[model samples]
Target: MTPYDAPLPQAPAAPALIDGFGRQVTYLRVSVTDRCDLRCVYCMAEHMTFLPKREVLTLEELDRIASAFVTLGVRKLRITGGEPLVRKGVMGLFENLSRHLRSGALDELTLTTNGTRLAEFAADLARLGVRRVNVSLDTLKPDLFRQLTRGGDLAKVIAGIDAAQGAGLSVKINAVALKDDNAAELPDLIAWAHGRGLEATLIEAMPLGEIEYDRTDQFLSLKAVRSHLESFWTLTETDHRTGGPARYVRVEETGGRLGFITPLTHNFCEACNRVRLTCTGTLHSCLGRDDASDLRAVIRAGADDAALKNAIRRAVDAKPKGHDFQIARAAAPAVSRHMSTTGG
Candidate 1:
């Protein structure tokens, strides 16, 4: 076994993780690869050059880093990417995680995908011990789907969602509220997801990275989304909170639950309990800030498990009190890294 495959060090007390802000950091988001099948308007530019295979983290490196966090009390791990499923041998990664990480140490091992490949991997994912899956789908209309995702098949995504449910996996739909795009479809989208027992999450578009569209013009506040949905439905607060920052509600009439992730209208940093490890192995303290620790370099330098764990602790200690996205302008020099590079 390599240094990364070494066993954990001596265990700490019950509370193993504490950030600089005195918050319990228990969730970790890891991006597997910086390659995607579809290029959406808000997520990435059209002509993006994908990362070389040599630059991204290997399965062993991911296991080592993730196991370090787990030993430190990170109970929930979400595998994300430009599109996680597009990466080959993803099921093998899930197998390693299931064998080592999720067999009781982790509370949940989930994934966030663009929903294009769910049909091909859903059954295997459920069999491999995934807790749940969140599929990013902005619109239901075929033409609008193609326009937004730059040539994605709406039927395939819908089929993928159905495939996940058919495999008995809990699914949630993630939709970003773009002002002139799918903002008006919130009620219908939530209703549609509810019809199939999936929660529809309306996310506020954060001004991050270089985009093909005018991000500011497309930015729809959660306040505006609430008002729009209230005109057509009665939404009462629900207690279905999770590790993420999405605030939730239930439809009074249809019993459909809706979620709002408002990085723009209402900041949820106080309850933020997670950290992101980009595909390039940069441990980002905050999504809105580019400050990161190069864990990959440390690991490749032959650090043992103890040293690796120390690096993780040091990175956690660097966690900021909050993000600057709340006051960030669209054109400002904040969060220049695209979502593809960073993960969900």
Candidate 2:
């Protein structure tokens, strides 16, 4: 283990993080690395150039940044990545962050992964105070799953899900709705997830980065998808919130909860109370907009806790009201950076 494996010193307390739009920033999604085993068509290209190892933040730095947010009244933390599990010694990060949960400073600590390595780490995650996990699985069909993830093994992801549940961690399925790909299979997939007593969330494709495939052709609106599902089943609106962008609904037929993340058709920015921190220590106040602040420089320069807290507050204060996402026949992505880089 690295020197960062040990618990960090307590950060000095700061005022609550409230954005310019009067939204209290309570949730923080930190990307530990921008590397993933799968090459999802919507997320990134098949052959991608990853960041150099030297440019990424150290595990200890990640702990310090996260602790700074906690000191500023952030209650929920979500570890993300191109795939967070792929980062070596990441469990140590989680273990260190669990101290907040034990001290009642953090209400929840979780991660979003592609589930390729979940089977190997689920037990440890549950022990590290991770009560829930979000697994990105586009399809249940083995061949289609392999196609969507570009050589991802469906069986392995399924095994990971089983292991996560076996380890007593609540599992949620996050499937990106694609027009020509898994759109038709969404209902069946929701049913399958419900049958296993797991929540399923469908997300509309966001035009984040340039890919070989046309996003317009791949874009599937959640509005239309919901209309189709309502024809088959009764979806009653529910007042359930997980401190994320998803809007929840209770499926009467399946007796389970389903969520929709519609960045294109609908905007959840008015109630946006979260920010994303990339692996390189760039803090993005708004996911749709590219306004960012560099916290890595502050910490790496040997700046004290007060400087780090000020840097975080500046980012939060500059948060935009909402994102401008649009999809057309021949238009560039709203944001040039990949969703992986932004901690999807």
Top TM-score prediction, candidate number:
2
Residues 271-297 of candidate 1: C-alpha lDDT, one tens digit per residue: 779999988889997888888999999
RMSD, candidate 2, Å: 5.3
The weakest ten consecutive residues by lDDT in model 1 span 325-334
**Residue 167, candidate 1: how far off, in angstroms?**
0.8
Per-residue lDDT of model 2, residues 184-207, tens digit only: 999999999999999999999998
Count of clashes, each model: 0, 0
Clashing pairs for model 2 are none
* Residue 106 CA displacement from its true place in model 2, Å: 0.1
- Alpha carbon deviation, residue 285, candidate 1 (Å): 1.9
